[model samples]
Target: MAHLIFSEDEQRELREAARAEFPGNPALAYVLENLAAEGIDLDRGRDWEDLRVEAGLPERNAEAPEVA
Candidate 1:
């Protein structure tokens, strides 16, 4: 296994990207665990959406957006 280095800004970007991909708490937790194994700490509280908003990432809707 190889060690990877990420800057602060890069870490922030990675967190946001992960949040965008895994909107649900369970899915997000899975992602965090994988990241932790890689030595990157990206854990969120119980409420996943709340964490996303706190991180300045856009909130994900439970339902799909209505098409015009």
Candidate 2:
């Protein structure tokens, strides 16, 4: 199989589409794994939050809350 390359804008669009269409589905995770395999660090910088909000998901804290 040939490897596919995506431009930054295309990547952003893909992320948005995946998140919006599969917010609660494993497909979203699949999309992100594929992107990671292509060297896109989705967890880096503000990409995570930006993508989630852009996809109409609620904003969430990056770090987990402390347990009592």
Off by over 4 Å in 2: 30-33, 36-68
lDDT of 1 by residue, 1-68 (tens): 34555766766677777766777776775676456445533342247677767899765566857545
Clash number for candidate 2? 0
Report the C-alpha lDDT of model 2 over 39-68, residue by residue, as the tens digit: 554445466667877899755556856445
Clashes of 1: 0
Per-residue lDDT value at 2 in model 1: 42
Identify the runs in model 1 with alpha carbons over 4 angstroms from their true place. Answer: 28-68
Top TM-score prediction, candidate number? 2
Worst 10 residues of 1 by lDDT: 36-45
Best by lDDT: 2
Q: Following a full C-alpha superposition, what root-mean-square deviation does model 2 have from the true structure?
A: 11.6
